[model samples]
Target: MIYIQLFFSFLKIGLFSVGGGYAAIPLIQSEIVNGHGWLSMQEFTNLITISSMTPGPVAINSATFVGLRIAGLPGAVTATLGSIFPAVILVSLLSLIYRKYKGTTAIDTVLGCLRPAVVALITAAGLSLSQTALWGELPVSLSSVDWTNALLFLGAFFILRKWKWNPILVMCLCGAGGLISFLTGKFF
Candidate 1:
């Protein structure tokens, strides 16, 4: 029964979440956090962080993590499968349709219009995640802020913009820095 619920929940996420994984964050949050109460907002935020740092889509990673937390390995498999199934089917269908309408102006126009909407979805997801990542559930006041995290974010943004470093390298460096901070009791 748990496995079935996990599968269907993620299946809903995969089916309706257009514009990719970031766009699915809100849906995933609603199901696992708000609906099921399986994870708190902070836990969900951490899940997103971990998902971003790992391979595969954020939606798949999140489904697997949440499923494992909820119902072990079987739940993980079911949720991961559910999260990918719609994408696989939709892409297959879209490929055929795109081939058939390869040069149609209507199709081109539709695709062009979708681009901005996708961008907007991604931006909204980022903003939603930022609220948690930057301040957790604390009130939006200067005294309640995590200054270390804010500093890290600013430093990372500056370095990335100035040096255009490889994103993987930046992530690794930040991970190492975080580990060091943890070991030294500088970050909590």
Candidate 2:
């Protein structure tokens, strides 16, 4: 029963997560954290962090992690297969049609329309995570704000947009900073 549930939950996630893995964050959060009560918001956030930092698509990684956490190795395999199944079928069909209709106005227009929606989904995911990062958990109070994190967020954003630093390097630098801060008791 748990394996079946994991498969379908991830199947839904895979089916509707049109834009990319980033766009799937909210859906993943909604399913596992809100719907199933399998993981808390903080755990979801950490899952997201681990998923994004590691290789492979975030959704796939998330499925594996969530499944493993919930059930075990069999669950991990089930969830992963479910997650990729839709993409595999859809991409195959879409590729065929795209090749056939490569230059048509309908195709171009549809693609153009989808671009904004994908951007919106990605933005929403980022904002949701940003709230957790800057302001602590939900039902957020101003007093819960982490000023250091806010500063780090702004600094990272500035560096990325202004100087175009390699994102990996910035992330590594931030991780080091976080570690040092932790050792020095800045987080407490």
Candidate 3:
């Protein structure tokens, strides 16, 4: 049941999401939040945050998270494989077309169109995560955001731009912050 749903949902996303994993965020969010009702808006936000700080593409990480939540390890594998299958097949086939269309205007136009859409999807993911992280019942606004988060975000941005920091380190820091925040809220 859940496995089948996960497969179908991610397969659709994998098949139609043209720009890659980030571009699939909106579709994944809609399916998880609206179509299946597997996760609440807040949960989806947390899932995006967690996924971004993990080692894989957001779409697959998201599918894995939702699948694990719904049915456990088996569900995770099923969802991940489903999400990957279409990309694997498509890319393999595209190799056959590359020789014919590598420098064509059609490919150029498609690439140009996809760039802005990818930016929009990434921005939407950030906005969703920000809304969930802040704006709890406390009535705080952006100016009242946690200073630690602000500092971390700024530091990460600066470091990423000025130097070649390993992405794994950035992910580790974010994951640590999420764990600390979650634990403090849970036990303290």
lDDT of each: 0.87, 0.92, 0.78
Model 3: worst 10 consecutive residues (lDDT sum): 129-138
Question: Which digits, one per residue and each the tens of the lDDT, describe model 1 over residues 20-108?
Answer: 88888888888989998989999998899899889999999999998898988988999999999999999999999999998899999
lDDT of 2 by residue, 93-132 (tens): 9999999999999999999999999999999999999998
Order by lDDT, highest first: 2, 1, 3
Q: Is candidate 1 or candidate 2 better by TM-score?
A: 2
Candidate 1 minimal-lDDT segment of 10 residues: 142-151
| Candidate 1 accuracy as lDDT | 0.87
lDDT of 3 by residue, 47-163 (tens): 877887778888889888888898899998988888899999999998888777989999889878989988887788666656555553246676656655665666677878899
Name every residue pair that clashes in candidate 3.
Answer: none
Q: TM-scores, in order shown?
A: 0.92, 0.96, 0.77
Best by TM-score: 2
Question: Which pairs of residues have clashing backbones in candidate 2?
Answer: none
Instruction: Report the C-alpha displacement of residue 141, candidate 2, in angstroms.
Output: 3.0
Alpha-carbon RMSD of each model: 1.7, 1.3, 3.7
